[model samples]
Target: MTRRPRVLPLEAPLHEAARIMRDEGIGDVLVTLGGRLCGLVTDRDIVIRGVAERRDAAHTTLGEVCSAALVTVGPDDDLGTAARLMRDQAVRRLPVVDAERRPVGIVSIGDLARVDGLGPGVLAGICQAPPNV
Candidate 1:
C-alpha cells in the first residue's frame, strides 16, 4: 500500500488535481470534505468526465466529477481482502482509511502484483473480469 496517499479538497479545481497528479507521479487523488474522505478522482475521470466533457478545468471542481460511491479498506486489512474488494468492485485502487474515514494509504493492483505468491494470476483475473456495466 502507498502510505500518505495524495489528497485534495472537494472544492479543488480539475487543473489543480491534474497538476498534483503530474507532480506527484500518481494516477488518482482522494477527495476530502471537512477532512474526511468523500470521493476519488482518477486520471481517467479527469479526461472522460472533465476534459472530454469540455468543462473548464480551472473552474470545474473535483466533487463534480469524482467517483463518490467509495469502497475503502482499513490499514489492518489483509491483501487478500483488498484483492477481493478490488475484483468485486471493479476498481483498480482502494483507499485505506482510518476509523474516522480519513485516508491513510492507498492499495493498487500494481501493489498486489508485487506480493510473492499473489502475483500475476490475481491481477490477470481482475483484468480479465467483465466490466461492471
Candidate 2:
C-alpha cells in the first residue's frame, strides 16, 4: 500500500487536482470532506468527465467529477481481501482507511502485482473488458 496518498478537499477545483497529479506523478487523488474520505478523482475522470463533458476545469470541483461510491479496504485487511475487492469492483485502486473512515493509504493493482502468487489472476480479472453498455 502507498502511504500518505495525495488528498484534496471536495471543493478543490479540477485544475488543482490535475496539477497535483502531474507534479506528484500520481494518477488519482483522494477527495475528502470534513477530513474524511468522500471520493476519488482519477486523471481519466478529469479528461473524460471534465474535459470531454466541456466542464470548465477551473470552476469544476473534485466532488463534481469524483467517484463517490467508494469501495475501501481497512488497514487490517489482508492482501487477498484487497485483491478480491479490486477484482469484484473493477477498480484499479482502493483507499485504505482507518476506523473513523479517514484514508490511511491506497492499494492498487500494481501493488498486488508485486505479491508472489496473487498478481496474475487478480490482474486478469481486473483487465477483463466490461460488456457494452
Question: Each candidate's lDDT (Cα)?
Answer: 0.91, 0.90
Write one digit per residue (lDDT tens) for candidate 1, span 67-125: 99989999999999999999999999999999999999999887877664854676657
Judged by lDDT against the true structure, how good is candidate 1?
0.91
User: In model 2, which regions exceed 4 Å deviation?
Assistant: 118-133
Best by lDDT: 1
Clashing pairs in 1: none
Candidate 1 wrong stretches, greater than 4 Å: 118-133
Which lDDT tens digits does candidate 2 get at residues 64-91? 9999999999999999999899999999
Our model 1 lands, by Cα RMSD against the true structure, at: 5.4
In candidate 2, clashing pairs total 0
For model 1, state the Cα shift of residue 116 in Å: 3.5
